[model samples]
Target chain A: MSKEELRMHWEDSFDHKYVKLKKWLIDGMTNGQFRFGDRLPSENMLCRKFDLSRQTVRRALDELEKEGAIKKVRGSGTFVNRVFAQPQRTSSVGILSTVLYEYIFPTIMFGAENILTSAGYGIEFGITYNKVENEANFLKRMLEINPMGLIIEGSKTNLPAMNVDLFREIQRKGIPVVFIHNQYAELSDIPCIIMDDVGSAFALTELLIQNGHKKIAGIFKFDDVQGKYRYAGYGKALRAHKIPIVDEHVIWFDSYEWLGKEMNWVFEEIAECTAIVCYNDQVCIKVLAEMKRRGLSVPTDISVVSIDDTNLIANLEVGITSAVHPKEIIGEVAAKTLIKMIEDNTVGNKSYSKVMPVEIVVRQSIANRKKMEKHHE
Target chain B: MSKEELRMHWEDSFDHKYVKLKKWLIDGMTNGQFRFGDRLPSENMLCRKFDLSRQTVRRALDELEKEGAIKKVRGSGTFVNRVFAQPQRTSSVGILSTVLYEYIFPTIMFGAENILTSAGYGIEFGITYNKVENEANFLKRMLEINPMGLIIEGSKTNLPAMNVDLFREIQRKGIPVVFIHNQYAELSDIPCIIMDDVGSAFALTELLIQNGHKKIAGIFKFDDVQGKYRYAGYGKALRAHKIPIVDEHVIWFDSYEWLGKEMNWVFEEIAECTAIVCYNDQVCIKVLAEMKRRGLSVPTDISVVSIDDTNLIANLEVGITSAVHPKEIIGEVAAKTLIKMIEDNTVGNKSYSKVMPVEIVVRQSIANRKKMEKHHE
Candidate 1:
């Protein structure tokens, strides 16, 4: 590299450090942490807090002084200027969810980020790992930063939430929050962008019944509202057809209990059933693997159906019948709703909360039980 | 009193004590503070915590066992029954605000309570004393109860908020929250039922300008969004009329700074002005009293205009021109909005967040500068 290029790079680094330190000081004043006439931290203290050199800290302080945001009293240190200490607004929104890489979350995040960034707003992303405690911590951190809006997916929504008070406080502070996927039963007023879980589950179950498959079994997650809604849809479809919901054919497992378990027990409970409805593509893959282990051919010995038409089942010889999750579209809608709330100051409007319809994709997963019996005769 | 009557009264008191203890235990179970199969507190612990006799605590435990909510073993401690330990939904809403007795809050509360109670929903009321810390404490307590919805008047809304995370957590939990009067700038999506401060302030200022008073002085609160909006309207009116705003003639104070202060300095800064615009009727009262102390007559020496045509200024000899505060109407609308959100599950709709229009209540305080000049001629 040329000497000029090296100097430019060094200067850019120097400028970045000072600009960051200057913003910290300004934020302190804007948020009233440093009120007018209040003394600022010493040069040594600033350097330690921001982890910058004394020269960089001095440059930041100098810029503040020049702009009249602070006054330097050589003996007394720096004080916020009574005249120039005013609140500054930020155009950033906080985006929080359970996980980014797992399931369809990456697509959702990508869709939301694209819209928010293009609209000239910065994003502060947070992950909760589906824990209420982590959600509270992230929310607390976000509130301190005071973003203009928020788009969040709830953590363990089917359970009694422990972090709802913090959510209420955020609303009280006038921040617009929009939820994607699921929301807590306690905060139904906050708009949520979600696919029609019940309808999709119903459609998947109906597809199985239409193929002359009766005595069907279902495996569902018990700790999330989405699972409950899907179960309800399955039950509704069964009831509509005058089919008795045999308790022995239904199984429930939470997030932690579903991993690396013996599938023999699950199959044993539903041994007499002709078909099974898995909760999603992820669960369907597990069921398919378990069937293969038992030397059972898909749509020959047993049939399968589920929700979320994701690529997880792409490599399987038989494509499982499933309903679309509307992954990216849900994210885009959530982001758009949040942005509308922010720009229009209509965060209180419940109309923006929407339920997207689902479409089912049929594959070679279900068997024609009636046709097979007639051919045998 | 008869012997039977006296005995009945004693029995009623005893029943109430045991019933309260039973309800407390059920609440703990329903809110997941105690999970299924969790051991119950010892009789001695319950007695001590509830300040009840051992017999009353034992009776409460017996009731739980009879209702199949708990199982008590002869030698072992009592345990929550796995089958019966399910979440029991409450038909109650939490109402939070600052200073229920001050200004128009009592009327607002009355309106909300009337509607909520009539709709068969119970009320949980909390006061914040306009402090964010108190707001947080109340919010935490309310979240534990997990009310169906929340109607809150934000505390210290003009300043940087400290309890917004709690609010966001509540929203994530699916509780609907509505704000009244003022809301924090950070959470603008939470529907707020408020009078149009900007429009009213403009009309009030315009009334002064129409009376031929161009050199106008104004005083506003700086810590509330309402104050900022009112100030905006005042500025807008001045700008529209092509009048330069004299910086020295305007003053801003927060909730804390406005109490028990001398107004001589205020008058000194605006001595040349013929009329002063006050933020609210409360501030106008203070200003009027100061004018009277200085032997200045209303409309003769100086005129005043303000918002909130409340009963606080009813006893004044000279009626000050002001804007009407919706008061109970705001409360009714807030309650209706909350109930709609709860019943229709439309809390995410921004259309419900309303800005109530303001009307000017023409009183006797404005001085006609043109008429006074003609009289002098």
Candidate 2:
């Protein structure tokens, strides 16, 4: 056909009533007004809404089905198709974290990067240093990039987030964001991949209790949800064992207060405790350093147990009995969930949130106080 | 004083009427209610608000002045001191950008990093890749970190920003943010260090017009404010020279569409023009490659002019006359401005926004069309 004829034909086809109806449906799905697997309005409803004829509406629906934009499930209704609803403009995923190279963050990032790169998607990565302000900045940048999906390790998950509006805006724009490690309570509808902090801390505390250590002191972080959950677990274990939970035996520190003086203060508060449960390996290491300075030996003077079985604990003279953190697994699961949501064009699908179970890694850090008592007798 | 005596004295001192009034003033400054250099309430107003006697209020003002938290002028009321208002918690600043390694970004980052590091402040860095989503993400992260200050190159600055709330929140928290390169129109209140894009583009285009080329084709980016300004300058230059602006000779492409095929399409649109003005060095390089593919020689066949005098143009077989981008200088100014704001504890101060002047470098790209016409005769 001549160029003029092609133009005329294109204009006529696009100007058709059925084609206009189809465009409206596509626009709705693209904007997340109609998400993946969502049932479209009844044919009669669409016809009335668009002021179109029944035959035109049916034609539009049939055309959409042919194009894989929707599926008609026999007797039910037409549903938005997951695969076809995806706007594959850029094959890139945004990955955000509080810390990229600290503690277990590197492994988590590596895990997510492996999955994303192997799937032929580029990565836009950022770190927030566990600060809500930094999280807000990174989220704003992510919104500008408009990646196919986002996988983020939330910052200060224990606190109320001021960036919930940004998260909601992202979802409204049809870009799925999956939380790794934890999520904001305000945005609880978003899917997440997280380790069971409460369960892990419970198991760790129980192990110490099983070793006959009743006088246990807990050192926990106050800024993150994981820390709160771990503290709860510690309290739960002590309660279950009928041990008195002394206020003086609990030491709470935020991200900024983990200094030499803070460690000394922690020891002073828990001076009479036989065992200590730390928030993480970093805290455990600090406590151990303080013990060493005081010329005390682990398991002999005081037993130390913590969560996050990082390599930092392995380098120590004495092994720390702790609960394992699913670092890389959290990243991998988060990436997979985000990719699924992106491909399916689903927004704020809570079904994808997975809390992995916990496991204890026994080491020499825990001492059997009951055995020690028998030996003394 | 003895410990008990000291405690008693502290309680007595703090419980005094003047001390309570002093605490309120400090709190106002801390929360950004009273900014640096802002005039505090009059002594009479403070007395009325606090229901304190004139002597008590005078004592409070005297204590504040003695501590350098506020300054009292002979005729005016006391003002918040810039030096004393800073909350010196973390010695770090966050630096955000759209691209880190591309074009002039590295040098710009280097300049800022040098200044920030030399000042004994650590850096928290992130990039948004010219995406609004990424900008939102990074801004959120910056907010969480609560860095002393933030230096950022805006993402998709020509468009309406969805991250303005995030920026406003950062300011509300009293964390100063300085924009490098360009800023969002919605956030015009934020300080920025940017080059004169409009004047530079105008000069570049006028240079071509001065070389006696009238039928000039222009290729410009559509997504950034820089592109819009550059296009405006180009049109202004054409109009100044009494050259009729032809719609067919102007081409607009966004961040996503500057590929080989797009360049070919651009050329097809401006096939009749004798010379071309490009958006930047990157676009100019692409145009050069396309012309080479078509076996057209620069200057001998058609002259090319562009902005951003990057090293890429220096390596070309033929030199292309372009405007200098002030790459590193932009970074230095941004860093300095941010540091000043941070130390002063000022938020959203527009006076710090610096629009650096532009300069053009004459190269071998332009052909003397007038000379060619006379030689043909």
Could you give me the TM-score of model 1 versus the true structure? 0.41
Write down the lDDT that model 1 would get: 0.80
lDDT of 1 by residue, B1-377 (tens): 55466445535674687887888888887776775567899998887665678999899999889978889988889998732222454788999988888898889899999999999999988887676656777788877887888998887575445567788877755578999888876688888789999899999999899999999998877656687678778877876786766656766665544773348878887999999999998899899889989999998999898888888887778888999898889889999999888775434446778988879988899999999989999
DockQ score of each predicted structure, in the order shown:
0.01, 0.01
TM-score for the A-chain in each candidate structure: 0.76, 0.84
Q: List the candidate 1 regions with Cα displacement exceeding 4 Å.
A: A1-377, B1-87
- Highest-scoring model, TM-score: 2
Clash tally, candidates in order: 47, 52
Stretches > 4 Å off in candidate 2:
A1-377, B1-20, B31-51, B54-88
lDDT of each: 0.80, 0.80
Q: Judged by DockQ cut-offs, is candidate 2 incorrect, acceptable, medium or high?
A: incorrect
lDDT of 1 at B64: 88
Across A170-192, the per-residue lDDT of candidate 1 in tens digits comes to 77555789988888777988898
State the C-alpha RMSD over the true interface residues for candidate 2, after superposing those residues: 22.7
